[model samples]
Target: MTVVYKLNVFKDPEQLNQNVFAAQYAVRGPLAVRAEELRAQLKEKPDSLPFTEIINANIGNPHQMGQIPLTFIRQVLALCQYPALIENAEITQKLFPSDAIARAKELLEETGGIGAYSSSQGVPLVRRDVARFIEERDGFPSDPNHIFLTTGATQAVRMMINLLIARPYHGILLPIPQYPLYTASMALYGGRTVPYYLNEETNWSVSVEELQRAYDAGTAEGTEIRAVVFINPGNPTGSCLNEKAIEDILGFAKRNGVIVIADEVYQANVYDLPFVSFKKVLSRLQTENPNDAWDKVSLISIHSVSKGQLGECGQRGGYMEVTNIPEAAFKQIYKLASIDVCPPVAGQFIVDILVRPPKLGDPSHDLYHKQIKDVHEQLFKQCRQLHSALSSMKYVKCQEPRGAMYLHPRIFFPKKLIETAKAQGAEPDELYCMELLESTGICILPGSGFGQKENEFHIRTTFLAQGEEYLKHYVAGHNKIMEKYE
Candidate 1:
């Protein structure tokens, strides 16, 4: 009496799209999954592991660890979520700050309330704010039409990849140990990934020679290199690109007719070096060489609220600023955005505040300034502590973190450890990270996940986890693993 379903749909991995199956995102790949399993187990059995809690140093997530949200941002978001709060004078006066109420009212009026869907491109007023912000930062004019508000920098990256990769043989040049998102998107869009290794000894700096080599190699292999992705204040390496380096990259793109996709999400996270936007540099070049072909360069620069001092990862707000994009191509990008209807209404609201926070005379100025300064100082302090700790470990060479929230240190594993990893069909760094996680509950990503040179071993750990006590635990766990191998 029972009907049998014939060949259950998508039951087998093979039933799914081959491209999806081939794509591997190592940041949240296996170790993160295992950490979650351990977390669940700890809830059931407190004594099941050596540590009481799982320390997630695997990703650059600030709030999940303990970073507090900015007071002004949350206040405005609260009012936006419930407009009735604005009508209640008692609640508004007691609970909300005057600046928060004013901002919420303005944004609510502009977007017609957070419940409604914004324009496919984004709220017009928000785009204007973004344009003004760009003008202030780069000292160059920006058009509201060229800006596309996105769920996050991740979505913008996917759209850019989709736009550039018209054929299966088209390739994108990505830095080795690059953010996995770039590689993952290229995979998803059926594009080739050509890797250009950063010079690790020189603070993981980019080399023009390496870029040319990568490009030439790809061309030799009959792959048309269409775009180059640069993650400034890089994700795993924590290195910031100087103005000169950015200029060189733009010149390369100009000469090769390749599209430049600059990921500047960590613009505010720079420590030792000043942050420079590719757009700013590009503008300078275009202005200087009025007769040259600088205007022919197509560039897409992206920024986000996730990694900056704002630390609004869950908000999922970001924007892509396009320059020299053809009118036809711009229409295609717009069409793609239209397919998604619009980004999150709340996210668009956050983007507005991100680009245009309180001014010097505003009511929330002092508190806002103090909160942002504290976040910056704390991040810098933690970066130094972790870098110092890792630098002292045996056979480990750690780079001083210049920007971003991670320290990717190279670990020289012993032959025995390598053999053990080979026996288990894993990379040496993967084995080390797994054992460290099992023994100490400190989850970090292996360098293999981010792509390293042959015979080189490394691990990427975020310094976002608070306190020196966990740092001591990490050092002890790491040394124990090394001693066992030795």
Candidate 2:
């Protein structure tokens, strides 16, 4: 008699954690994956698609879209990675600048080496530097103890969500059409997402009334609203919140006894308006209303090296500054970080460079400043050009994004197109985007992936890709689809 073997338990999707399976990240979701497949096919066949190459307008990855890395950052990182280079003084001195070498030596002593594990919080010196940077930016004192160097802002947000969502019914107020990371994290941690819609017609402004209404609805349903997330110079919407908006949000959080998680990774990407930090606004409130317990309002402000002029997405450097969190809670948060052992040491090195860059008259100063300026001007120019193209399309309406790398445009699908999408069990925007990718070899995300009002459609695309030729193809393909649907 032959023995029979059981199949692997994890072979069945049901056997795994459903939360992991249920979470959706549309930025690198199905459409982006398909784009990769098409890219491979084109590599082999060379004539597989109508267009010659795939233009990845899907995600805000600048370097992948042809952004040049800054010289100082790379040079310092190189020295740190291999101290042998520094030891070979004459050769290294000629190749690397004096300051970069000195900076690398300083960081190497603090970090031990790139391969070693840093403090679970981060390297003490780097954390202190980050604190100093925050103090200067916000005009408020920052505690190094409260600063946690993360893999990126993504990890920082995840840590906060994990700490706050203690129960299944605990909830967080998230903006509709948010960066999917927020929603995905909430789902992973098993919490309710109370969505507050932004006013798209009014430049995607935040209304305090909507926040109150969402909070009330969640509370009514027995959800303990733990925190509210604000993405200034927002991800998909690209709307920058004014000082008044920041003040109103802080007041709402203070009154409701909820935490404020501000995602300000795009702080350096502002074009139309000045980028203001939540920490600054909160400090001002505390100073003005000394007796009003503004100190009780807790906040976690996050920033990253991935989105700015640095564009070091692969390097994975970021920090979170926590204010007014209780001692007990802060300790628990530290423990959570310790469990991960530490973030990437190389990433920590990047964070150090990010906070303290070359100054005036430094050997690398002029080149670094010029590169930064060029990137900023190029990105702003690209944003304006893309916005004009989308606005000129037949049924597309786009708001000029104030900051951030992406643009979200509302698309009016014809009745027939909507009915066709329904028949296919897909959102109209999703269907349109898929067709667009196949025809144009240009990948962009659908608005449905980022949440939208009922019966309306939109799409999110990054203006990171360079050149005008691909844009012409995009416009032509878009109008062709509209004409066909009409």
Residue pairs in collision within model 2 = none
**Residue 267 alpha-carbon offset, candidate 2, angstroms:** 0.3
TM-score of 1: 0.98
Query: How many clashing residue pairs appear in each of the predictions shown?
Result: 0, 0
Candidate 1 regions with alpha-carbon error over 4 angstroms: 1-4
Error of 1 at 105 (Å): 0.9
- The TM-score values for the models, in the order shown, are 0.98, 0.98
lDDT of 1 by residue, 65-168 (tens): 89999999999999999999999989799987798999999999998989999999999999999999999999998999999999989889998898889899
lDDT of model 1, residue 384: 92
Residues 89-108, candidate 2: write the lDDT tens digits. Answer: 99998999999999999998
RMSD (Cα, Å) for all candidates, in order, is 1.0, 1.1
In model 2, what is the error at residue 166, expressed in angstroms? 1.4
Reference-based TM-score, model 2: 0.98
